[model samples]
Target chain A: MSWTMTRKALWDLRWTTFWYALGLALYTLLIAFVYPTFREQSAQFEEIVRNYPEALLRAFGIEPGQGLSSSFGAFMHAEAYGFVWPLVAAIFVIMSGAAAVAQEVERGTAELWLSVPESRPRLLAGKLVALLVGMLAVVGVSVLSLLVAAPLVDAELPADAAAQLGVVLLDFLIAVAGISVLFSSIFSERGKAAALAAAVVLAMYLAWVIAGLSERFEWLRYLSIFTAYRPREALEGSSVSWAGLLALLAIGLGSMLASLAIFRRRDILV
Target chain B: MDSLPIQVNGLTRFYGKTRGVDDLAFTVERGEIFGFLGPNGAGKTTTIRLLMGLIQPTRGSARIFGLDCWRDATAVKSHVGYVPGDARLYEAMTGAQFLDFLAGFRPGIDPARRRMLVERFDVDLSRTIKHLSKGNRQKLALVQAFMHDPPLLILDEPSSGLDPLMQRELLTFLREEQARGKTIFLSSHLLYEVEQVADRVGIIRDGRLVAVATIEELKRQRTRRMEVAFSMPIDLAQLASVDGVQVLQVREGGRWVELGVSDGLPVLLRRLSELPVVDLVYAPPDLDSVFMGYYQRQEAITGERAR
Candidate 1:
């Protein structure tokens, strides 16, 4: 693959990556700073959490016994990794993927791009690799922040669990990013592609939430990509869920291939 | 492989029922500046897009150095540099960054070459594209297309926002490129620019190639309007003797005769000089009038066939 577009994508994303890393780091520190207060009132917090029903506790990705002050991994999941990381990371990937092709077309830059010697597949492959690299950076910062900051607040953070969960989150992000790119290829405008991808992500999250609420909605989980990720399980285990990772990677790769086929055939009319 | 830089045959594209270009056919010889001219929506951009492989032809093919434009577009692009009609570079990037990004793809381009073009265009590299004026942005677009120096340059309305000085500079540069054996496919509605350097021009109208003529041939084919004023009143027969000259109106009692000269201008001028002559006014045919004449001829032929 020609590294031309890959370098451009990385260069274009440098500022975005830096700011996001700093923001997520600050967010992690905020979580760490509040840990002590939760620990000081651990008994009261646990008692109050126990009063809630099992269904409600499961919906929040918290075990009945494991409440606010239980452990750094469980608390981290309930606070940042479970909701915030996925949400922010989805926004980043969705924006990146939508901007990859559709935004260029909409803005008329793709005319200059397509006129060059580089093949369409090579250009797109470069963008895909760049997104994956950005994901690694985001995931790395989130884990490192938790590992270094929690200790400063007199709380012990399991580095291995945080790293393992980061890996699992990265895997899930790849799947979402692939679909986002596919949507970008289908639409002529970036805003429409981003909106559609965000709606799909929201739908999957809702499906997973509904599944968590009751047994009658259990089948929805299988249909949702959120079912592919279980941060509580990923953090609790010694190793990542390899089967789930492999399945998500496959879906991501398949969607990427489809995107290539569609983008290659699509006319750059603007 | 064909030695010609471009060869288009029976190319047609339609947007639903509306024509983009219909049965367009032409070729650009190596080292020649071929001016592709048409009024807006007459399919100039569409035909260029077809040649660039940015869009597919609905009917036929455009080949560059023998490579099919659509099927082997990537390979075809390797030999071409392009400036889009309505240029929109990355609005977020500075001029330097945009140049670097494009240069990264074309490894053969040297740093000195880009610097030379930047100086030639007189654009600041530090400022973002959105901050630049429209003419400056067009200059940046020109720099990028010319910096790589591909064998063929396909420019669609390249002089859209340029002032007169820059326009002259561009025409001079095109001549220099032609001297170096680079083939240029210049598409525009501006007759002055094309008339300056085009070795030949192809006129497209209603998505069809109406005429392909050298500068000399086009000038010869266009009707010249002549006005003559005699020392005294003369009869219509005095101006009507020349077979090629038709009296439009016998103004001032035939002293000032408005005549349309379609052929043998030398004969008409010789005949006019022999008159009791006072003053004469002649209007040389501009490209616009030439184009209108061709369209009117087509309409007349169509009208006859309809009858």
Candidate 2:
């Protein structure tokens, strides 16, 4: 990858990265601040969670046998990691991947870029590296915020919970980034790329929810990337599915390579 | 390097079933300024994009410096500087930053030349691109293209948004690049601009190249307008007999006659000199009229072939 191009891509995304990191960090801190109440009223919270219907529990990303007041880490996973983190990271990845090529084409900047000596793959690799860096930086802010707010809320997290959560978030981002890049590679408009990626992510989440409602729909879980990221299972024990994690990473890598190939052969419509 | 800096053979492109350019074959020699001229949607930009390897041709190929444009585009592009028709700079970046970003893509770009171009174009590099006017944005594009000092320059509508003074500066710069042995392939619809700078011009119409000629050759083919006021009325039959001269009108009761002269201007002048003892005025054809002449001729030929 060309560092010059990578640096410029990162520089171009600086403001977006800043705002995303800030927002995610604030959300993590809010969860940390509210952890104390859940711990104190554990019985009441458990009763309320048990009374909810099974489909409603699934919709809220509440796994079977996992209570909201069981552990600080479990509470954090349900409140932030289960749904909010994936959504936020999906937005970040969509924007980054869409801006990678489609946005440039829409703004007519791709013409200037392709006119240079850099090969198409090199250009794409640089942008991908930049995006990965941005995602990591945003996740780093959440980790830092969680660590800083833990003591204030009198909460206890597993020693490696932050690191495990970081891995899960990274996996989520890379999976969505793959879809984003795939859509961006096909469309010349950033709006179209972002919209398609958002639709796919939302559909995947709904597929997982709808699948959990009945045994007949269980097959739909395979269609949703969320199935690969069981944060509740990861928080309870060290039982994160290595296969699922690898699958998420593999999907991202596979999609990225496919995007590069398509971009190489396709006409830049600017 | 090949003596011909550019070589395109049977280049064709289609967007679905719609033709972009068809069977385009041309060559641009070293140090020559070849102008690709056509009105909007006539496939000028499509051909340029093919040469730059920005888009693939449906059939046929384009080569630069003897390297296949698509297969060896990275190596070919190392020696080419391009100014696209749409000059879109990163809005958040200052002009200086934008140039720097482009320069970073190529390893051998000259800082000295970049500075010179910045000064020559009279652009304020300190301001963000969003704040710059259209003309200033064009200046920044020109600077980035020239700063690399490549052997070949492909400019598509390079002066679209520039003011008259900046346009003149651009013309001067192009001439200087030619003197330094750079190959230039510029596309434009502005007849006068092409006529002023192009050594050879290719006119495309409806996705086909209709005419290709040197400036002087095109001038020779264009009809010349003339008006002659004779001291006395002469035999209109004698004037009509002159080769390639058509009488347009007889004003002042046949004392003054307007004529269109094509190839035999010298013969027409001689015939007029024998009788016009009063006055004469001649207007050489403008580039627009010359351009139209080719289009009309092509239509007539197409019509005849249909018969």
Candidate 3:
């Protein structure tokens, strides 16, 4: 609601947005350039995938003997979405979210902001909105790279693949950012907030990996936020669960609301 | 006109079991320069924070402009311009940009006033905040708080990093604001800073209101420090036995005796003239001696009488 506050937040975090977006675009370009070699060696790679251990393939979210190398979207899933995008989103969320509140407190700058006539909710909302815009830019660059690279390789990414990748990637980013902001709101120390948020994301990733390797631990997958985004399946134009997407959206909104509730009543130590 | 700019009644804040400020009740008239004085960790910042609505009171309430500080914080804050004890400006932006960003929130802030303040502070508005030194940053904060020209100014340790000249400039600026009928609440641990401009002062110690008096009243109870170097060693008991003279220190085998005299200066002077004296010096009173005199349970000055 406060455009001035939002503009300040964006200006403060412009470099962070630029670097993350650049990294995603470069990584996507690398994968696109290597796609031709992967397509030529598809048969051999398929044989290798078939012979690979089932547990490892499941952990990597790759179906054994499938046509992963045959499609650029599927290749992107196994190479980027299965891990890289989530990791990037987690790091971005942790840094920006902590900077939103915890960094202000530690540096004793929140006093200046809170002394103004604006309410706490409005200030926080503007910061969070700016962060969301940054995340969108990062993911948008990745999508643009894929669209630009696919035509040069004589490969077409299905419309469904492009749309689903953007949606689910954004969903995942929002969820992780919400959790980061929640922790940032609770702690006055930015380092502590970032550390806790990172630990939670890593723990969730580990839970999903371990749970995928065995049937007995399958219940752990539900606890991981990453489980809600089945990017590979979504790219294949199958198994796109609206329920899962909604769950992720709900997590994002819920955590943000909780942060607002606590931040409104809590003392700003700075 | 508006119910005394600040009214705090039995305001107390407890950090869990530890007290931040205890049973503090005070009021500031509409245009008086009220100084809240205390040592470090004596709860001056806590009181400021509570009034700013950055923290809630554990026991009582603070009202500004007749509105509850907690429930109607936005309304209360709209009338107040505050400078925190440790002000950290946005280091990435130029001073002009930071001031512009602050001015955007308040509708009544005039651009001409902002320009005037920037010129008065003599800070390079084009330089990034990180490039500015500590004193320059303080000047930036002062410009931000004063540019808006709010009716009430709550400043905590406002002169901490300024050079002596700038400090004097700030005192003069505050006097001008006072002339314009602004209600100023200045909090400081340094006694002399408050004494220089404060119309009234409230001394807090150990999370309690120890004393509150006008500068005139506090000066009335002040003691003078006297030192004498005798031609020969004299019995120190002669000075210690006086009604209002207390021996503070004895140096050089009692030839030099430092004394704190509140009421018996004449009697001590009479006795000194009778003894063999080589050198005598009288030092004007400092706040420490005045505080020491009051700390020893001399006539207790209470805020109630001032109210």
Candidate 4:
């Protein structure tokens, strides 16, 4: 990739990345500090989870009372994965992905960049690299804060819990970013592309949640991108070869490649 | 022998079924400023976009320095610095950051040249792009486009947001650039904007090139106008029978009249001689009228075809 262009994208987006990562880290640290207290009354917390509506528990991918156990990873997953990470990651990547290519054309800056000495593919590749790094940094800071705070509280996270969290988050972030970039490449307006990509992600999450609510609709889990990484499985210290994970990875990477091709041939039309 | 700075052969583009520009052919020689003139939506921008390879031609090709604009765009771009029709940039960037980022893509952009352009344009790089006035933003665009000192400059309405003084500065800059052996393609809807600096002019109308000539040649074309002052009001309809004369204007209760003659001067003069004419003044067509003649003729043909 053109490091010059990649550096430019990163520099321009430095503040955005910093503030978002800082927020994620602060939230993760707060939850981790509180997890030590939950460890003392882990069985009582599981009983509270059992008191929740059966439909809500399924929607969150939580078993009757399994996720909120004494393990630090399970506690973190029980608190964050249910709704927080998916929402935050979707907003971050969708906003960034939409702005990547489509917003440049919409703002008329594509003329300057497109006319520069770099080829279109190289330019796009640089932006995508920046996006990948930016997303990783944001998630990495959040995960690192958990790893750090767990020791401070004299609490232990199962190795499997940490590993599964990485797999699920990485898989989710890649697929969402790829889809968003694909939409960005197609539309000249970022708002339109962002809206549509966000809608698709929202639909997938809703389908996943809906699938968990009923045995009859369990088939809808196949329709959800999150079908691959079960939060319950992750808390239980399982490997990541979960069903459809590869397809999700393929869809994410495939969409990114498709975006590159589309942009290479697209008329900036600014 | 070197190829011309730019050459387009039968260039055309369609936004789906509707044609944007059609069958356009022109060449801008090296070290000359070629004015591309057209009204809004007349496809001037389309031609510029095609030449820049920001958009591909549906048929035909635009080449720069003998390189296919679409296929060898990177090579072609190394020779061009373009100012887009719209000057919107990343609002979050300070002007200095924007230029530095732009410079990062091209190797060996002379720091001296960039500094000179910034000073000449009087742009304040310390300010964020969003805070800059429309004119200052235009100046920023000019600075980046010229700083590279590329052999070719494709400027689409480069003076859009500039004040009159800055516009003059830009024209002077263009001259200096031409002297530096740069070939410039300046697109504008206003004729006078380029009339002062362009070595030649090309007028496009309804996606077609109607005229391509030097400014002097366009003014010195066959179209001529005569102002006649009648001693008193007379029947103006009788003059219509004269071939190759069109009524351009009638004033002062129809006693003072101006008629445009593409030919048939003798027949029109003989007819005018019969009227109660006190005086007549023969005038060569100005650049505006000369270009307007092309526009009106094209409009008439379009009207007729529509009918």
Cα miss at B131, model 3 (Å)? 1.5
- Model 3, clash count? 0
lDDT of 4 by residue, B66-104 (tens): 999999898899999999887778788899999998998
Error of 4 at B109 (Å): 0.8
Name the docking class for model 4.
Answer: medium
What candidate 2 gets wrong by more than 4 Å, as runs, is B224-287, B295-307
Model 2 residue pairs with clashes = none
If the candidates were sorted by their DockQ against the true structure, best first, what order would they fall in? 3, 4, 2, 1
- Per residue, candidate 2 scores C-alpha lDDT tens digits across B1-307 of 8547999899999999999999988888899999888888899989988888889889999999998888888888998989999778899999989988998888877778888998999989999999999999999999988898999999999999999999999999999999999989989988778878999988887898878889887776666667889887878887788866668789887899887666676777677778855888887555455655565566668999999
Q: What are the runs in model 1 whose C-alpha is more than 4 Å off?
A: A50-69, B223-287, B299-307
lDDT of 1 at B243: 63
**Residue-wise C-alpha lDDT for candidate 2, range A104-191, written one tens digit per residue:** 8888898888998989988888888999999999988887788788778887656476677778778878888998998898899999
lDDT of each residue in B1-307, candidate 3, tens digit only: 3588999899999999999999998998888899998888999999999999999999999989898888888888889989889789989889989988998888878888888888887878999999999999999998888988999999999998999999988888898899999999999887678888999988887788878889887766666678899988998888899987888889999899898777777788889988999998887555565667676444335544556
Best by DockQ: 3
Candidate 3: misplaced stretches above 4 Å?
A64-69, B224-228, B235-244, B263-286, B298-307
RMSD of each: 4.0, 3.9, 3.4, 4.3
Clashing residue pairs in candidate 1 (N, C-alpha, C atoms within 3 angstroms): none
Per-model TM-score, in order, reads 0.88, 0.91, 0.93, 0.88
lDDT, model 2, position A93: 83
Which parts of model 4 have CA positions greater than 4 angstroms off?
Answer: A65-67, A158-164, A213-217, A231-238, A242-247, B222-246, B251-253, B256-288, B295-307
